[model samples]
Target: MKLYTHPDCEKHEMPGHPERPDRLRAVMQRLSESGMLDDINVELAEEISDETLAMVHPPDYIEAIKAAEPEEGLINVDPDTYMNNGSTRAAKLAAGACLQAVQDVLCGEEKRVFCATRPPGHHAELASAMGFCLFNNIAMAADYALRDERINRVAIVDFDVHHCNGTVDIFKERPEVMVCSSFQDNYYPNRYLDYTNEHMINLPMAPGSKGGEWRKRVEREWLGKLEDYKPDLLLISAGFDAHKDDPLAQIEFDESDYEWITQQLLNIAEKHCAARLISTMEGGYDLNALADCAEQHVRALI
Candidate 1:
């Protein structure tokens, strides 16, 4: 397993916000204290180029995001999203980390990779930034991976409390990519909650759903589709916000739930994709819960 992150990821912050820099700080601190970092390959993520970002986002939208960055104070992009001086670079690096992970896993340099960057991207759309996301990081990485002829099919599994509307929007018509998202029903970014297809699996659990409910639904809805698709690579939008302690939602999951889901994905990866999996951080607000869940996810990856 390998870990990719950048210091700039910690620079994109808004005071008193749930998506604050301390989120990453807490996860990193826990990983270090648990000696998990010592067991994995850690690399600083580079900023993604505009050319690559353009694969998912329009060029003008890219320029607009660049222009929206404030020099002195934070600028609001939406009700839940903000931009600061370091926001652009942080978003770039966050996306870049996933891109690099794609390259590394495909080239056989690593089997599993975890990107512990912030400003999660599962909510960002092709031409808009929302839900604290500036770019669709995993979507861009998936598009980048498909460039390699060897990777014909890719599966993206998102277990976030909120829906990965941006990911579903980008790849809804692309048959080559399969998106399986399990999120809280009637939740934030409510777009595409009712959308589903042969390649897109939207599993929406009711509010107050427990880990067992999530597991049964996933096993019934996701596992068989994943096996049938037989993806060449697996990507995870690993969000821990579904935890019982998270303030933003009403789900009851703990670190063990994360571990269980990771193992399930790992089994599929090992059977079909040479264990090639790249997981990037998404929504997880409670600092301690985020740290503990993230650590367990990484430990399972290891």
Candidate 2:
């Protein structure tokens, strides 16, 4: 498995925010402590260019994000989102990591990749930044992957506690891209929770839902559709926020659940996509749970 991250990602944080730098630090520290990084191919993520980012975001919106970056302190983008001096570059690097991972996977340089970058992107819309996301990293990478003639179909599986409203906003009209998201019911960024098309699959779990119920729903709702779609590439918005220990939501997922989900996605990738899969970091609040869940997810990918 290939792992992509950058120090800049840890630089984007606020003092009292739940989505702070310690989240990334804890995950990375756990991987290092467990010697997992030693076995994986680790690469420093680079910044994505504005032109490429424009595939999913408009030029004006991109410019606005850059312009909103504060010189020293945090500036509020939304009620739950903030940006500091390092945020712009960190967000770009995070998005760039996904782009690089997609390119490498499609080019056959790697079969599976996990991007451990931050400023989670599943909630950022086409022209707005919210839910602690500046750019829709997975969406941008999917758009970038579709640029290649060989990749006609793409599937994004999101298991974040919150729905990927931004991803749905960007790809809802495009039938070639199928988005399967399992998130908590009545969660944050509550757009598209009930919206579904031929390609967009939304699985909203109840507040106290556990891994068993989630797995059952996945088998019933996602697996068949994924097999039928036969995507050329598979991308995952890997989020650990649904874990029971997480403070952000009420879902009762654990490390085992993350591993099981990863294994299922890997099976789909191997069968339909030639194992071409890339997962980008989304949300996971509690440090210990995030670290444990991320390690399990990567172990399954490996």
Candidate 3:
């Protein structure tokens, strides 16, 4: 497995932000302390090209985000998301990390890759930016995997606290891409699970649902979708915010739950997609839970 990250991810953080530097710090520290950090090849992600980003996001929106960078004070794009001086580089590296993971996995250099970077994607849309995301990194990776690698039928399985509304919107009509999400319903940006596309399988869990309930949805809904789709590649929007310890969301899940879900996904990927998997970091607020759950997710890759 390949590990993609950048120190710049730590730089773009807003002070006292839920998606702060300590989140990455705790995750990296846990991997190192658990004697797992040295087991994989660590690659500093390169900058993604403009053309690559434009495949998923509009050029004007990209330029607007770049222009929104503040050299001095925070520029609040919304009540929850803002930009500091470091946001541009951090966003670049975040998108680049997923892009690199896709390239490496498709080239046979690595069968699976984990992008441990920040400013999480999933909430980001084609022409809008919100939810602390400046760019939809995994969305760009999906486009790259389909277009550049010439691989058809890709799928994104998201288990975030909130739904991947942006991903569903982008690929709703595109049969080649399947989107499965297990997120809290009636949460921010409201719910858009009404899309007519059967490929977009959304299992909306109520707030405060436990890991067992979440896992059952994965087994029943997502796994069935995975079996039927038989995707050429499996992409995971790996978010750990639903952990009981997470400050931002209400759900009960531990590291073992993360391990179980990853193993399940990996099993399907192994059977159908040549084990070509790219997992990208999304939301996880509580540092300890995020770090621990992320390590568990990584253990399956190892």
Residue-wise lDDT of candidate 1 within 1-302, one digit each (tens)? 89999888999988998999999999999999999998999999999999989989999999999999999899999898999999999999999999999999989999999999988999998898999889999998899999999999999999999999999989999999999998899878989999999999999888888998888888998999999999999999999999999999998988899999999999999999988999999999999999999989999999
Q: State, as a TM-score between 0 and 1, how close model 3 is to the true structure.
A: 0.97
Q: Which stretches of candidate 2 lie over 4 Å from their true place?
A: none
Q: How many residue pairs clash in each candidate at the backbone level?
A: 0, 0, 0
Better of 1 and 3 by TM-score: 1
| TM-score, candidate number 2 | 0.99
- Once fitted onto the true fold, the runs of candidate 3 whose alpha carbons sit more than 4 angstroms away are 148-150
Task: Estimate, for each residue in 1-302, the C-alpha lDDT of model 3 and write its tens digit.
Answer: 88988888998877788888888888888988998878888888877877778888888888888888988889988777889999878888899999888889888899989999988878887787778887888788888889854588898988888888778767777888889887777776574755546788888878778888888778877797789899989999999988999887777877799899999989989999999999999999888789889999998999
Instruction: Give the per-residue lDDT of model 2 (tens digit) for 181-229.
Output: 9999997887988999999999999999999999999999999999999
lDDT of each: 0.93, 0.94, 0.85
**TM-scores of all predicted structures:** 0.99, 0.99, 0.97
| Residue clash pairs of candidate 3 | none
Assess candidate 3 and give its lDDT.
0.85
Sorted on lDDT, best first, the list reads 2, 1, 3
Name the Cα RMSD for model 2.
Answer: 0.7
Cα-lDDT of candidate 1:
0.93
In candidate 1, which residue ranges exceed 4 Å CA deviation?
none
